[model samples]
Structure formats: C-alpha cells, structure tokens
Target: MAPKEEATNAKNVATQHSQEEQLLHQLPKPNIQNSKYTKRAVLKTLLNRDDGGFALVGERVVVGGWVKSSKETRVPIFRSFLKLFGVGGGGNGGKDSPLSFGQRVQQQPVFSTVTLQVSDGSCVASLQVIVDSTLAPPGRIMPSGTCILVEGVIQQATTSGKHTIELKAEKVLHLGVVEDHEKYPLSKKRLPLHTLRNWAHFRPRTTTVASMARIRHELTHGTHTFFQNNGFLYVQVPIITTTDSDEFSNKFQVTTLLSNKATEEETSTKASGVSLESIKASLKEKINRIEELKRTDSNREALLAAVQDHKKTNELALELEAEEKREKAKANALIKPDRLNFLDDFFSCQAFLTVSGRLHLESYACALGNVYSFGPRFKASTSQSTRHVSEMWTVEAEMAFAELEEAMNCATDLLKHLCKWVMQHCHEDMKFVLKRVDQNIALRLQSVQSTEFEKISYYKAIDVLKQVKDKNFTTNVEWGVPLTEEHESYLADEVYKKPVIIYDHPKEVKPFYVRQNDDGKTVAAFDVIVPKVGAVIRGSQNEERIKMLNIRIEEQGLSKDQYEWYLDLRRYGTAKHAGFSLNFDLVVLMATGISDIRDVIPFQRSFGKINN
Candidate 1:
C-alpha cells in the first residue's frame, strides 16, 4: 500500500538535497594565505574569505588574537581516552593509533578543554578556538583581554551554534596572560565611553576604539593623498613660535622659566626682600644722608662721596622700576607670564605652542604656490565643552594668489574628498561605527560627499536665523556679535541640512590677519559649518597691504613686533593669498557621529585631563 508513496517521498527528499548542494557550490570561495609580517594567518583574512571560513576547513594555520571569551568543558576518562586515541571515533583525533603528547595528557580521570572566542582587532568578527587545558592552562587564557598565539587546524564547529569555523589548537605558541581578570577594566561586556577614556591604553582592544583607530588612519591617508595629488607641497611648520597665529591670546606658552629650579630660585629671591620697594627705601636713605652732610657743613670730600652713593642707589631704583613696567607690559600684551622675566628664559623672549599653522603655511605657499601643514596644535583654552580639547591635530592649507572664494572652494573640495575617500576605503570600520555609534552616519557622509556645500554671506545667515520659527538660539543673533556654536549648528543642521559656508563676517569678530571688506565693517572671512559638529573649517582672505596690516594689527592691540615677520611677506612681494585650518578631530566626529571630541583622539589632553 505504501511502496509507490514511499518512492515518491524518497525522490522528493533527494531532489531537495541536490538543490541545496547546487546553492552551496554557487557561493564564492575564499582565497586564504599567511601574513607576510609573521607566519601566523590574519583572522580578518580567514573570516572574510568565505561565509563561515568553510573554504579553508582542512588547512593548518597559526593565529594570534586576544581572548574575548573562554569556556572549559570536562569529559569522563573513558570518553576522553576514546576520543584522544581515535578509538572508535570519526572526529579530529579518530584516525590516530599511538597516543600523542596531547593525547597522553588527556588520559586523566577528567579531561578538560577550553573553547575561546578570539579577535585580533582587524575586524569586528572573532574566531572560535578550542585548546587542550594541559597545553595552555584554562585559568591563564580563559579571562578576557588575555592574548594568545597558537598553531591549529581549522575545522567545522561542533558546539558553537554561531561560529561555523573553529580552531583546534595543537600547540600554544605564546601567552600574554591577564594578571587579574576581576580588576581588568574591559572584562565587562559593555562600558561607557567615559569609563573607557580612563583606560585609553587598553581601550583600543575594544571594538569601538579599534574601529575609530582604523577610521583615523584612513582619514590621515586620505588627507596626504588629496594634498599630494593636488600639487600642494607638504610643509612641516614649527610647533613652537613667537607669533600667535590666531591673535586669540589662547596659545600655550612654551617656556623654561617655570622649571622647579627656577621656581625655587625665584621664590628664595622674593623671600629675601630684594624687591623694587627695598631698592627705593635704600635710595631714600642714601639721599637723606647726602642732604644731612650738605646741611651740617661736613667735609667736601665726604659730602661728594655721599652724593655719589645717592646717585648710584637712585639709578638702581629706576632700573628696577623699569623692569617691573616691562613685565607688566608683557602681561598686558597677552604674552602671559607668572611675573617671570622672559628675557631670562630659554628663548630670551616669549614663545608658545602654535595654536594654528596657517600663518606659517602662508610663508611656504608664497614660495611653493600651494602648501599645507598637518600636525598637533595646542590651545590654552579653559573650556570644558565636549568640542574643546587642549591638544588636537589640524590640517591647515594656504594657497597663493587665491582670495576668499578660491579658498572656500578648496576647503569644500577637500571635505568632500575626505568623506568619499573614507567611505570607499574604510567601509568596514565605518559600518561598525554606524552600527555601534550612530545609525545615520553612512547617510550623512554620503550626503556630504554628493551635495554641494551652500555658500551664504554672514548677513544672510543672520537673516535666516531671525526667520527661523522652530528653535530658540541661546546666543542672540546680531550684526556684529560672533556666531556661537549653537548658531552654526542651526544653520548647518536645521536650515541647510548639510555644510554651509558663512562668509564676510564682522571685522571686529575676525582675527587681525583677515582682510577687511569694502564696507569697512566686515571682513572677507568664511567658516565651513557642518551638521552635528559646528564649524570644522575656518578660512579668510589674508590682509596683504602693508599699511592695512599694520592698521589692523594696531586696531586689535596685538604686538606688531611679534608679527613683523608675517608682515614682511606683505611688505616684500605679497600676493593676495588665503588659507584655512580644518579641525581633524571634528571631521572625525562629523563622519562617525561621535558626540564627544575626546573619543576621537588617542590620548586626550583636555582641561585637567591627561594620561599616558
């Protein structure tokens, strides 16, 4: 009764199996190989080769990675011996006859094996590895953050439902055991970004920090490539300089006058009553003695001696007074000092960690036609905002014979190129960032890469802000008032939904180097404001006329002597040039949608925050 029906069912099952086999054959095969740097194979290459790494199922390879998770399993002596000696088994050791070194160790009352999930940080995925407990102690390699390098054969997973490929280790080549798992910061599965900041040295082992590092590398590579391809020479600018590029009085002073020895010496000197007041009192006493000698009809030679002493003492008093005035003048000029004489410092004058490289880049641009400087910059800002950092990397570029418009165009092109470059080259990291950090990061980057940045005058921007009906800006938008970050965010995020360049800012609000417009009230300056992160790029047409430069420098109360070298470029063959600086960290924040600027940098240097 069932012969014909059973035959039909058997035929149907066979057809289904054949179709599944055809689908498997159609899938792409992975081409896996060992790394050139080491004999060990890269986990990324293995995992990304084919789906589940099935293509290299039977290959023997060495791998090195940090342990993500580990579990130990114990089996009965009878089953352990049977599996170890390949007695009536079909698994990895089923074909062995004589007991090997690993097998001999496993022939105990209870044999233990450790299963580990390991990652090398080359990608988000981790590989499964099984190791004999005797080869590598379970207590040593079981905790998270333990690093191990092992030689193993890739096999199909037998227990882990998620991982299709697992490594069966024959030997433990190396072990970087964690001293204590409970005290480790990254032992927990999830930690807040702020918490990770405290452990920056170990944070890179985490997925988020690793992904950020990769993205940062790609962006840096892209930066150099873009500049090199565009005929712009890379110029290394001085990190220490006498001139304040931004004229903002926010530069960190680079001085040796505050050293411990100097401080102790100064403290002792101050405590010894050797100040100007003491000199003045001594001068008065000497003058009074001379007067007494003159009035008492003393000997002519003695009176002459007293008058000579009085003159010498009076001269000392004047010299000390002048020194105090000079010190006060230096402080008023924004060359901040703790009343320490800069003339006695290492440089013999005031010096500072450069806040921007644009001024220096201009000197190179004048000669090289186009030039750029990329390096660390410092600002002595006391701001504790999420956007402010005491130390950061910046990309500043200057173009010769280019005005504000040309500079703006170059900045736009550079931004678009960087966005496109990272999207293409750092696709995996960007995807990880999108998944873990922000969901709309990819879309935001694509929009920036494709859309043309809108250009509007500062007056126009102010008008647009005034007309906005939905949001209340904290800063009161006005004609001469500087645009706050909130104002910039509104323009770029709410009004334009992309980058917006606001140009022709008020002259009072811009730096002295910015060229004044014909209206005499505003300067030919522009800032490229991006969504989420306010202004990322700030550019301006430089003041080239010598007379105007002097006037502007004087108007801003800056020391003209400090910028005379910069002014010489204008005095001697100054062509109309413009330049801008791009905040590299902010660009990262924009691309990754990371809210804090501290997360992007490796070792954050913020207000009251520094670590090795």
Candidate 2:
C-alpha cells in the first residue's frame, strides 16, 4: 500500500474507535440476543438484526401473544414430498407478491399444516410461529384474535420479509378457546378503520390498533417526562367539578334530577325513622314477649290478648319490611326524573364533568409556581365530525408571570420534544403507521422537529387570508370573525406549508379568562396549528386584574356567582399567569398519521355512539 493511503486508513480506524468509546460510556450496550439466550425474549429484540443480530436459531423461548391471524395450510397427501424442500413450512405463503420466496407449493386437501402470526406487543411487527399440527394441534380451527402461549425454538428465518425469525412450536402451552368463530368480531380479512372503531376492546389485538396504542402511550410518557424533567409539578385536577372557567364551551352537567324521586323517597324513609337493624330488633323483642307470656304468666284471657297483639305486630312488621324493600330497589336504580330545583339536587347548585383543568390548575400554579394537569376532558357537543369527541384527554399547564411569547416557546419546545421522543422510541410503530395509515405523518412529525413554526398574530393571519382572495374559502376571513378548521388548515398546509402559531386573537372570539391586550380589541392568546390538523393547542395569558376579569365576565353575559371562586383566585393574588391545553389523543392522532380522532382514543365517545 502507498504510505499516504495507509495513513488515511489508520486515521479512519482511529475515528471509528473514538466514536465507539464515547457510545460505551454513554450507556451500557445491549446484549446480542441469539440462540441459547432464552430467559425472556421480546419481539423487537428478536427481530432486530442490525445491532449485531438477534434471536439465535435453535434457542428455546416462551413467547406469549395475541394471534393476529392463523391459517391451516393442509399439504395434500400427494404433495407431502414438497415439505422436504421446505415449501409450505414457513414461506410468506403468497406466490403472487413480488417479494415472495417462490411459487408456494399448492396445499393439498388431504394433509393439515398450521401457521400463526402472533404479536408480542414488543413492537409493531409480528413473530411468525410455525405450528406443527401433529405435535400441538390447534383444535378444529385456530381463529384470529385468540391468545396463545407457545414454548418454541427460534429456528431458521422465514422467506417472508415481514418476519425475520420463525418459531418452531414445540408445544402449544395454552390455547385460549374462541367460543364461536363465526361470532368473533375480528376476522382474517382486513377491516376498515371505521369498523375497527366499533370493536375498540378487541381492536388492540390487531397490528394497526396495537401499534397506535403503544405510540399513544409513549407520547404520553414522553410528555410527562418533559414537564417533570423541566421542574414542573404533576397535579391532578378534579374530574367532577362545579366551575366552568371557560364559559365559551358547553358543559356536560351532572344533575340528581333523574334519581330525585328515588332519592327523596330514601330521604323520607330515613326521616320517618326506618332502619333495618331497628326493625329486626323490634321483631325479635315482640316475639320474645310472646314467648315470655306463654311460659311464665299465662292467664287465659291475657294469653289470648297477647296472641292477638303478636298477630297485629306481625302485620305491622311485614308492612314496614315491604316498604323498606321497595325503597331500596328504587334508590339503587338510576335516578328517575322529577321536578327538582337546582338547590335540591345531589351536588346542590350545579356540577359537571370538567371541560378543561386550566382554571383549577391555575389555583395550584399560583401556590406551586409551575404546575400542570394531565387528564381526560369532557364536552357535550353533539357534533359527529372527525374532530369532535364527547371525551378526550388533554395536558394543560400554567406558568405564573408568563407572557404570550413565553407560552408559545414552551409549546414549541414541547412539540419538538414529543416529536424527537416518538422518532427515537417508536421507530417501528412509526414505520408501520407510515406504511398502513397516513403517508404524510412522517412529514408532519419532521416539520415540527426540523422546521421552525411560523409565528403570526391573529391580525397578520387575517391579512394573509385576505390577500388570498383567489381561492374561495368556506369560512369568512373578516376581522373579528372566528377562524374555522378550514381556515387554519389552509394557512398551515397551503399558505406556509408548515406549522403556524397565531396569537393575539380578537377579544370577542376569546374566552373571558384571556387577558385583554392594551388595544382593548385583541386578547393575549395563541394557537398552534399544524399542516393537517389546523390547531392542536390554544393558550393565553389570563385576565389577571380582578376588576378587568369582573368587567369582562359581565360584558360576556356570564353569571357573577359562577366565577366567584375563579375571581377570588385573581383577587387574592397577583395572578399574572399563562396556560395552554393540548389534546393528548389529538397529539397521538397527528403523530401516528391516523386520520380519524375516533381511532386514536382507546374507547372513543363521540356523537350518539358510546360502546361499553
């Protein structure tokens, strides 16, 4: 070798060595999983071949998973010789697909061979399990969605690109019996996303649902970690509340009027002094008196009268017992409707499932400095659109003495954090989603991480919309008019081709709690909009001045008493604060490339549909 060439090669070797040393010090390297290392094995670890390969052939491992699809490819008695060539054992089975190993040996109608696709929940991919019918039978049929535990040896790779390592089943350790194959909701054929929504409970067993579920979970954990690591306290806001800080949205009311009559009956029964224990005691005492009368002092006339008295006591006790039974049945049932006044209901005036934890979170923020509430939120909207759901999860945070720009910065950081976390941890799931669901999800996530979100005031957004008169918009773009989803989508997807953050919205368009800017027309508010979904987050600096809050409440036609506590929060403290709420499921939907909001939530409650 030439002298200069040898020196260059040596330098390259040294650079590679330095990189390896730094990586080792950063974290302990993962052990290569191959044959003979079988205490426990995960799907990702087994399928991963890049990091020095995994799932050694001939390793005996116990794998538990829900069956995605199971097929019994019976090789005809005549084609039995084809097994010698390994035709039907673990090939992809599709002869027509471009990537198939070869033309699949046609299965004969005579002999039985079973192959199962199982997901271990370790990642988005499935583990090919080659089941030998003679060794471990799958009953009459191995239905899709059945859970099974199989102790098997990870042997030879399958011809299919879908699975890297195939497990040769030694025994069918446990096979969950599917009561009726015909009635099972999940079948072998691919079901539409909407159809999957109908079977949320069992949908997770499928690859799409399972992958989306893990992605959502990782996003949630990542979000919590970001805040927790950044010196933020995780505070839980109440689910049932009487306060509606944002008066703009309708609340899902909780009233006792339905069970009012039953409740009243119960109350009257208690007031009338009917206790089961008291009744039982009285019955026993009367019987004892009768027994004493018969045994000790039995004058004929007195004995007769005592017997009559006992009969009368029996009737009265029976009637009381019947009344008690009736009351209990009524009270236990859902409340029946009645003309109940607001003050006479269960919670008294009014109560509801919280629309947002922002208002309550603020109280904690004032005391704790920086705090956040991440929990499910409810809405009573009857709309059946893709964006609207009766119930969803949200993360709302409050920063004391913060402004619109600071809130926007935090939001940008959070979005980037979430994107990076998903890319790093949910790589397989993202790849699966990109292949099966939305093709644009990768770009959406990349835009958040690599590109800067365009920041523009509400006025500036209006100006941009007005300039684009060539394209007719469904929603009017006039100043002071509310910008709908259509408007936001256009600005992000069409105009800027990126995420757009719009702040300083019109005062009338914003809630009463949003701080009014000095201009008196716009409020200190901002919304984060992405390409596909218009606005994912909305936040604002609160109306800190007690007098200003009161005035805004009155001007907005809000009840004075409803916000008394919220007003007290401002009245009692300096209360200059800002907060924003991002829908957790929405984030998952955006990140996973899921088009419908319904598919993202595990159990979605939307419009007139809520399946238990």
Residue 375, model 1: lDDT of 98
lDDT of each: 0.86, 0.80
Give residue 222's error in model 1 in angstroms: 1.0
lDDT measured at residue 420 in model 2 versus the true structure, 0 to 100: 91
Could you say which candidate leads in lDDT? 1
> Which regions in candidate 1 have their CA more than 4 angstroms from the true location?
1-34, 50-52, 83-108, 159-164, 260-338
Instruction: Note each model's CA RMSD in angstroms.
Output: 15.9, 14.3
Supply candidate 1's per-residue lDDT for 220.
Answer: 96
Q: In model 2, which regions exceed 4 Å deviation?
A: 1-40, 49-55, 73-112, 139-141, 158-161, 262-339
Give me the candidate number with maximum TM-score: 1
